[model samples]
Target: MSTTTVTSTPNPSVFGQSVTYTATVTGITAGTPPWGDVTFVIAGGPTIGPVTLTQTGVDSGTASVTDSSLAVGSHLVTANFVNSSDPLDNSSGTTIQLVNQAATTTTVTFVPPAPVCGETVTLTAHVAAVPPGSGVPTGTVTFIISADGPTVTGTLDPSGNASVTVPALSVGTHQVAAFYNGDANFAASNSPLTPLAINPASSTTTLTTSPPRRSAVSR
Candidate 1:
């Protein structure tokens, strides 16, 4: 009979982060290294196929696989080892893996960076996962303009960008920021205050014509 043990690196991993699962087989007779394959079965996760085991020692063998698409939750990871020779019996082992939500950063920007009063502008928010984490963040981003100013919310697109159009702003300086409402796989975040200035609209003057021309011609 053979004994199998399973283990995972970075047991507590962030969503979208890569994790490696390894299976070690032992309890082999003297001078006869174990030979066969090992397969990984994960609950609520993808199943990894039969990876041929390699003899790491005189009486032990090892197999490993790496995966990066696990969901954000606890998973029951199992390793099943199959022995090619009839003399040995197949064995299995189990382990636990925890995946947490990834952190995110939010940034806000507006079109017509330098704008004049009475000119419409479009505000955009971008949300991205922190380093070591990958994949676009989903959900809504709420935009606020100055204290007690106008507020709007926009949904995230495939590229993690949300945009909303606002009417002309008053001529002055205003603080703008974006707040990202996180999804199941990512954490919420707020952007730093972005200062914006709106210049005063230009003015135009018109002249009026009088009847003096007609009086001069008569004289």
Candidate 2:
């Protein structure tokens, strides 16, 4: 009979990140190494391959494969050994692999660098997956202004951008920020606080010219 054990590197990996799994078969008699292939299977997931085992010692052999297509969830991984050139019985091993959402960054900006009181302004938020993890982040983003300001939500587009229009901001310095409600493939994130200044509306003046022009014409 033979015993098989399986393990993974970077057990808890991020979505779309590469992971390697290895299986080792042992329990053979001294001076006799096990020979055959090992197949990997994931519960509720896809099957890897029938990778050939490499002889490592007198009684043990190993096989390994790298994969990067697992979704964000906990997976039950199993390795089954198939005996081809040995008299040992087939064996299997099981292990758990965890996948987490990719990290994200959120940024908030406003159109029209300068704004005036009582004018409508558009606030935009952009979300992106952190390095080592790729793909555009989806879902909604919430926009917030200073205390007492309205809270608005906007759905993201294909480019990971969301926008909301805010009308009638009082004249003063207001802090604005955006929070991204992450999707299944990316983690939530918040943008740094940004200060927006809304200056008071421009004042208007009226002037009148009187008899000075008439006196000069008479002269």
Q: Which candidate is the best by TM-score?
A: 1
Find the 10 residues in a row with the least total lDDT in model 2: 210-219
lDDT of 2 at 28: 57
For 65-137, candidate 1 gives per-residue lDDT tens digits of: 9998988999999999989885357999999999999999999998999989899889999999996677899
Candidate 2: C-alpha RMSD to true structure equals 4.0
Q: How well does each candidate superpose onto the true structure, as a TM-score?
A: 0.92, 0.80
Candidate 2 matches the true fold with a TM-score of: 0.80
Per-residue lDDT of model 2, residues 26-109, tens digit only: 955777788889999987567988999899998999999888778889999899998896645799999999989999999999
Overall local distance difference test of candidate 1: 0.90
